[model samples]
Target chain A: MSAELKKALYNISALADLGQAITSESVFHEKIQSVFYVITGTFLANRGAILSYDKSADRLITVTQKGFPPADLDRVDPEKLMSLGKNEPFLIGDSPVLAIAGVKILAPLWVRDEFIGVLLLSGKLTGSPYTQEDLELLNVIAHQIAIALNNHSLFMDLSDKLEENRRLYEEMRHIYHGTLQAFAAAIDAKDAYTQNHSYRVAKYSTAIARELGWNEHDIEGMYVAGYLHDVGKLAISNDLLNKVTPFTPEERAEIRKHSTTSHNITSKIKFPWQNVQDMVWHHHERLDGCGYPEALAQESLSDGVRILSLADSFDAMTSQRPYRKKMDVQTAITELKKCLESQFDNKIMLVFCKVLEKEIKGELPEPDILPYLDRDSDLSVISSMLEAIIQELSAP
Target chain B: MKTVQFSVTSRLVGDAAVIYPKGYLNNLSGESLVKECGIYIGKGITKIVVNFSETDLINSIGISLLLQIIEDLKNIKGTICCTNMSKFLQDTFEMLGLIQYMVVFPVESDALQYLKVGKV
Candidate 1:
């Protein structure tokens, strides 16, 4: 092969290597600085700088530089530079895109036939006009530089879009959280006696989870499960919910459907944690396959489900109800242990016992005086009154 | 203790409906609030001044419902202003970006002035 052909092959190989490294470099300043060194060294030039075109803004931005005056860099116009012939370097005296000193060669860079930037190289170290072969090598190098700049631009744009998406996701999450809190409050308002039941359940569930060494997300999932656990009861009658007497067989059947009902209501809301739905649905289920709705056994249950069950029971025992006396801390603790391995998960019960061990031993705060309704006299009378009111509202 | 029931009373003044809500504004109250606003919406009296002078103890549920009311009013190119908000409610509204889209007044007179002018 001819000497010219061999030199050109080596130059192309060197340019190919530079192309690979520049595409992967993350920081723009470092990337352009490295490419500027390569350009200056390849042409044996004294000074150089890259002027990258911002096509959208119709402006030029400084990519990198070596020995160029700041004023000259500011004065450079990328549009005018891009209009130059791809191969030809303009002499300082003859060039139209000048007022800068020491910059003797200007070459426009392109990739896939699209102009991307300009390489401004100063007078040669030997102080002579660049040879035809020097320009040839520079042309190949310029193409590689263009490819790198294009890749960098695309990478920057993608990063900006990703940041924008993250912000939007956070905004939507805030909205959903506020909405869910309102709905949870609505569930608590199902009856005057059950007020704040969801909030208390959520707190107790997370406390047990913390005692059991569950991760933050699992603990939070338990809280969400507790908050949304009783939403299904919305479809049941307020009279039934607030009735002080033990429900009859038919009434018990109506109440049993609430677990599944809650699951259905919360499923539409789409909680961040999927397992929360299972926890809500299976909270009433027992260990020996006697639980309602799903009748899920020990093996079918997640640890979170057990934690929720424990929290639900703990709050129910402590809460003041007009008909049934509230259980003391000692009685409640003993009751949980007595039914362990049958009605509740033993391990989760242990965790709850340990976490509340301090609070149980301390002063017992008086429970609130909840609005009381009896099924025998008050509820039936209230039911009729409520029915009358409903009829009145519905009437034209 | 059980929460008190929520109630809203509305009166017409010029072209606006001035609403006064009583009791704690939680989940139960939030529902009544929407229905109260709905009555005005139905009547085509879109200019509204919701006064909180008689109420306090609003929760997240109440705030969510209030956001809905504001959005409904905006859809009709109508203006709604809130009056007599405590410092806490004002801070909550500003933090949630609610103030960006609506004006909050320190008194009923200020709200009425804004509603009369229909812009802030």
Candidate 2:
């Protein structure tokens, strides 16, 4: 094989190596700077700098440099470099080097479509005119370097997109949870008897959902829904809702409609819980088809809805209601256990019981207690979370 | 200048309210609709009739806020009856799964008639 052929093969290998390393390396800047080092070291050049055009400042900035004073080379403005024709090798005389170093060969690092920057390999120790071979090698190296840089840009963009998606998802989740929490708070505020009921239910439901091996989304929905399940009771006449005496049959009919009313309220929302409206609407439903409104019974409701039904019942049973004192946790669980197939799904009930046990043990902060019906409800949870928000909005 | 006129009217039946809103529900004019509905809540009105007979364009945020208001009303045991929605709005609402929580009516009178509890 000819010497030229061997050298060509070696440069190709170098380019491949550079591409692979740039693609995989997580330490971004170091990998980029290393590309210049690879070029300078591989080509046996005396010095080199990778000059990238700054679109913003409308100048060139030395992204990575070697064999030049790192600080001074860093300060050199790219805009000062005059426009060299596509194929024109940047001459030492026409170059900005006239003001700086007594240069020898300056080559434009042309990538596929455009000139990326110039590779300044100053005054060869050999004092030779750069051969066609040297320029070709530089061109190949430049191509690989550009590819690496573009890849880096894309990686940064993808990372940014992923980050943005994550942030928006979290914000939406927060908004959803906040809305439920607000609704819960409003419910508690109105009655004053069920101060901590919604909070307890949210915690218990979240734990139950997690125990059932539900994903974060389902767990979050259950937590939020549990908190706001009783929000419909708010529409119940405060007079009728808070009345200690037994309700008249007409009032009983009004009370029976709260679930559907609550469902109706949530139905307007466009979240993942398209079914939650149904679940909330049907939470009071019995397995015997004796439940109000739709009278949906066993196997008619989804497991999630059933789980919510069990959770709502458990919370209501254990809460200190105006009409009834809070039942003990054990009694609440037993009551739920007895209601299996009649109201709560047996399998879900078992899991819910375990979840309730976990809540009593204090494993996590009560998950999103207040149901925020809107942005306003969400803001009110953090004890002056809204204050900071109002302050920011009110700021000049 | 193109004009998009949207109007919402509220009628109270027992404890519920019926809101008759006409015109577009997109981000541009959703604020006015929200403000109008908010007035009902402020007046201790829970039940609502949202008549979307002539409404158009419900963006994601607008839909979100509308849902929020519904949820708010739920906490208070109030119902919002959406009536006279266009076929386009109805399809979008169904696809978005809003039918689960909200009841829809073909006409304003049907919703008022169904939602009303007094005298048949």
lDDT, candidate 2, A1-396, per-residue tens = 454665565456556545654665447666665465445434545466767655556655677664577665556554444455433455575645434464455555445555455556665433446667766666666566666655555677799999999999999878867777787898877776667667776676676678889888777677767776777888877788778988899999998887777878877877575456666777777887877678885778876677777767766775667777877554655576566667767567656544433333444456332231123322223323323333433457
lDDT, residue A77, candidate 1: 76
Write down the TM-score of model 1's second chain: 0.88
CA lDDT of each prediction against the hidden true structure: 0.71, 0.63
CA-based DockQ, model 1: 0.00
Residue A343 Cα positional deviation in candidate 1, in Å, after optimal superposition: 1.5
Pairs that clash in candidate 1: A232-A262, A285-A291, A286-A291
Alpha carbon deviation, residue A162, candidate 1 (Å): 1.3
TM-score, B chain alone, candidates in order: 0.88, 0.80
lDDT, candidate 1, A234-277, per-residue tens: 89998898898889999999999999998887777756676988
Question: Which segments of candidate 1 are over 4 A away from where they belong?
Answer: A1-28, A85-93, A112-115, A207-220, A269-272, A328-330, A353-396, B1-120
